[model samples]
Target: MHRFKGRVGLCAMVALGVVTACGGSPDPARPAGEKQQEQQAASRSGEASPGEDRAVTWANDYCGAVSELVRSVSEMPIIDASSPRRASETSGELLKVMVGGLDRTLDRLDNLGAPPVDGAERVRRDAVATYADIREHAQAALSELSAAEGPEASRDAVSSVRKPLDDLGGVDLLAGFDTVPALQEASRQAPACRTLTDADPDPRIDSPGS
Candidate 1:
């Protein structure tokens, strides 16, 4: 029932590195030896550092999960406002899929832990908070739909969460990588992560009314 909006603007903002939560240049004063160590580690690992690699890896996985969830939501049959029972059933199933996907995504992020690079801790915290907020909103929407007694009430319940859901749709999973030069460069080199482009728009769910 909640109407989500175009995430194009959010994606554009992210592409422009305008996310204050994760925006900043890497520290210029970092020791030269540290850079050398990172390069040496990259050689030994034959890939990015553990932290940057993990961030890219998890980001790719999260993107896949989000894509699948979007596909599922898009494929769902639209329910009539007069068919409250059908709406409830369909919405329940959709929310279940969404909540599960979000949980798994969060779990992967948690397991990956924050990137160990300088100035990345705050970005990681913000990313995790954003994911948690989306999950909370989804749960709340589900609860509202479940508690509604009739078709009109159910529609109203769904409508109430529209903005929250829209906000979730606008979240940029890669926002955390913007501030870390190492991660950004690594993401560019990684095929899986690199495939995600500024021009690639986020997947969207249609409003219930549509």
Candidate 2:
């Protein structure tokens, strides 16, 4: 199977690994769509001028979300291509993990409310939208994998899964946060961010959770 290309999201780090992967359901405490509603409510509440401490908190939260997403993606099992049916099923499982992880990450990012920075709303919206798009890609891949049958057809479908993940690899989820210098600096200090930095030394991008 094709591996994801260089330096996209943390997911790319393990995209090279094949096999089946799964788990990472969204938080059970918050029903689906509640995050969107809460985000909208928070948006209407107006922005606060966060001091240094608050800014650091925001960065830490973002970093924490990212770290979780990476861990989830890394759980995907190695694909067993020796059996077509098994390979197809495992590939589908991996896609499920991708979709679920992205969904959970998006919810976490939403829960972060607005980052404390100028143009915070726009930045948040763009970052969320980017991740949402990636999730959609993974969802589409899952659908394609589900419909596949036969050895040849299933192999083709399994191969298709790489594209969406590759697209994900090309994105920098954290790029939106860089618009605010203060927040960017604050991210450097976040212990969670440091953990991510250690995982993949490349500059972090926004992920579903980040």
Candidate 3:
């Protein structure tokens, strides 16, 4: 249980690893007329130009899926260690939530097609593979927790859960785009991705009202 607490603390930090997208700076030399023409063209096309629209769509969807995952994981219940049964029950429920969240995120990633940038397929494939591993570990932890019968067993099961959560905390979304400038720019334009920017770098949970 002690080890789990240490690892669980990383959950927030890991979720916060997503790169925050920043809006691009306006061109100082471009003529206002050209900007207006671009806007008009976009409006006439029903939205942005086809290429731009696809990039934004992909970015937004990606960010939204990630946000859902962070929220679900963040909702992990504070375990009451005083009672073995209660601890097991709460921990089990958290595993269920984690599994469900992972499952949904995996589906979304699978259907995202691919990012709209160079090396898009490789990035998408890597992300899917990594998340699949995380999900598998989570399922294994759930099974361990289910089979645990006593305090020592329960503690070990919880430790198993934390190992993956700790690894998750080390995930760095920006690292994945180290060579992809266009993908980084798309992330900056994506409004949903701002959650990463707003995330608390050192998050702490408060007990009930104290």
Candidate 4:
């Protein structure tokens, strides 16, 4: 992905993770298409019954956030690109993995409508850990990217974030929503999310849910 699309957004961190904070929008002329897609995706959440669309939308949005980061990292440095150049950027792309993972997790959570009050405790605990893992690795990469300037370092830092996510793949998380499906769905959730939050948001239309 291009640098413009590399940094990530803190949607979950702002809306769900921590206290809220307001801010201005991105470049208006840069491209309204992405914004429009995001709006459409958000609106979709409100459109269907709680689980109907939220699971897919949220998951896709979440995954897309990280995917954008992945793409950003992947695209960083020209083999000659400066570290400061790459590191100074990427909140847009890198953080998306956590955001996307949370989004997808939330969608499953909403769908399941909170696990049982008994063993459900374990699920929540596990989820928090999962989310934390997502956040930690992403943050680590971003921090390294921010600090380094060499293309090799920038690339290495960004690539470092990939394995953790790859390890997270196809976990059958969210009650049979396999990692592949969840990631694919999350990827396909919105045109805008894809336009902005994803490095490669192309729908895996080959699979019905992907």
Q: Which should have the higher TM-score, number 1 or number 2?
A: 2
Local distance difference test scores for all models: 0.56, 0.64, 0.61, 0.44
Q: What is candidate 3's CA lDDT for residue 58?
A: 71
Ranking by lDDT: 2, 3, 1, 4
Across 1-210, the per-residue lDDT of candidate 2 in tens digits comes to 112223324322211122111346556797658866765565577432235456666777776665555655666656678888988888888778777778877887888856566755676677678878888878877888888767788888888777666666666545666678887776676666655655453443332222
Query: How well does candidate 4 match the true structure, expressed as C-alpha RMSD?
Result: 16.4
lDDT of 3 at 150: 82
Error of 3 at 117 (Å): 2.1
For residue 166, model 1's alpha carbon misses the true position, in angstroms, by 0.6
- Give the TM-scores of the predictions, in the order they appear: 0.60, 0.68, 0.68, 0.36
Question: Which 10-residue span in candidate 4 carries the lowest summed lDDT?
Answer: 201-210
Candidate 3 ranges with C-alpha deviation above 4 Å: 1-49, 173-175, 199-210
Candidate 3: which pairs clash?
21-188
Query: What is the Å distance of residue 61 in model 4 from its true position?
Result: 17
**Candidate 1: clashing pairs of residues:** none
Error of 3 at 115 (Å): 3.8
TM-score, prediction 2: 0.68
Put down candidate 1 lDDT per residue, 25-102, tens digits, no spaces.
756798989878867866686654445555555455444434433444444445444666766776666666667757
